[model samples]
Target: MKWQNSLKDYQLYLKIERGLSKNSIDNYILDVKKLIDYLDANHINISPVSISSEIVQQFIYEVAKTVNSRSQSRIISGLRSFFNYLIFEDYRADNPLELIESPKIGRKLPDTLAEEEIDQIISAVDLSKPEGERNRAMLETLYGCGLRVSELINLKLSDLFFEEGFIKVTGKGDKQRFVPIVDATKNYINIYRYQIRIHTNIQSGHEDTLFLNRRGKQLTRAMVFTIIKQLVEKIGLKKKISPHTFRHSFATHLLQNNADLRSIQLMLGHESITTTEIYVHLDRQHLKGVVEKFHPRK
Candidate 1:
């Protein structure tokens, strides 16, 4: 089949069957497109079913020259998934990249802010402007809920259930989870909703969306990144952080305070307990305390 035709089918499967978000599908397609582009640039004419592992390996070797190991590993994973889909669909008998191994990369721990630093970041919001309250509420909700940037942007007015102290979050693969919201977070959200959001002329499709830009449309992930970047610059903090940093901080602080891993897993909507265990970034003092308190020999 033509590369484009195969890609279209792959995207359809990702959306309809896999339930992956648009951004995720785009990245997978981009990985395949990179391979296609390489073949075209080299004057090689080959169909998806006919492409050999050697050609794929050549493309990967060239990609390694430009991207770091982590990114290279992701590209390899994306391509492997695509070929696995092809094999499942009977388009190919086997994956071309099956013999090729992804490059080994170390497990990179997430950077977390201290509680005081988190407060400083939130305090950097200038309350003089209308978006100030909205920004504070957004940041608070992000940290309080341990939300991914996508989850934060897609939050809806209907999702808030303050009376029950829980908010419904639609996470990756369109899976839904109920995460408890603290009264403080609820108050900030309520403040923004009643005071600020009500004033904006709501857009047609995004009326139920909790957070919006000045234009009333839902905020993009890039916009969220930009907001945090400006705040870090304003506060003169030296840590490289993103919207996810707040999430890391949330989980880190909770773990540091003795919250269980399983509960954090449920709150974060992680599919695996192992994924949640990455937040086990406990310091030496906490580790020592745990050993002293719970060790059998102690």
Candidate 2:
């Protein structure tokens, strides 16, 4: 079979069966594409079904030279999954990456902002401009609800349950979760929705989308990143902050305030409690306080 045919099938499997998001599928496909590119560049004509471990190892060797250990590990994992898919389809008898082992790397913790820093960044938004209220509301929703950028942009008007004090969020793999909404977050969002958003001549399909661009279209992921970047620059803050930084801060602040991990995990839409445990490492002081306050010896 041709490499392209196998890759197309793999992409469909990832999307239809695995239920991965477009970004995830693209990333997985990218790893296979890199191997294809390497083979074509060297004039080596071998199909995915006929490819051997040595060639795959050589491709990984080339990848390792340009990327960090974490990235290298991820590429290896992505390729492994692709080959496993081939095996599942009976295209191959054995997985080429079966014997390969990923490099040992430490779990890199996410960066978080202090409450004051978050305030400073949000306060830097220029309320004089028309998009100002929208920006502020977006940031507030991001931090307040601990939403991913994709979730924030895809938020809809119908998802808001203000009377119930919750907002339904569509998270990874299109899984839906209802997160508790604070009164402050609700007020900011209402200001944007009722005041600024009503004035926009919203496009046909994006009417239900909560946030919009100047053209009344739905906001892109890059647009959200740019908004946060400008706010960080405006405050003269040196940290390399992104839309996810607010999410990290939200989780970290909650953990510090004695909120349970299970609750935080549910609110953040994490599939596992282990993913939520990173915030525990962020607040050693909070752990210390917990030990001092509740331990039997204390």
lDDT of 1 at 98: 93
Instruction: Report model 2's TM-score to 2 decimal places.
Output: 0.97
Quote each prediction's TM-score. 0.96, 0.97
Look at candidate 2 and tell me the lDDT of residue 232: 91
lDDT by residue (32-146, candidate 1, tens digit) is 9999899999999999998999999999999999999999999999999999999999999999999999999988899999999999999999989999999999999999999
In candidate 2 the C-alpha lDDT for residue 184 amounts to: 98
lDDT of 2 by residue, 128-219 (tens): 99899999999999999999999999999999999999999998888899999999999999999889999999999998999999999999
Runs off by more than 4 Å, candidate 2: none
Q: What are the lDDT figures for the candidates, one per model? A: 0.94, 0.94
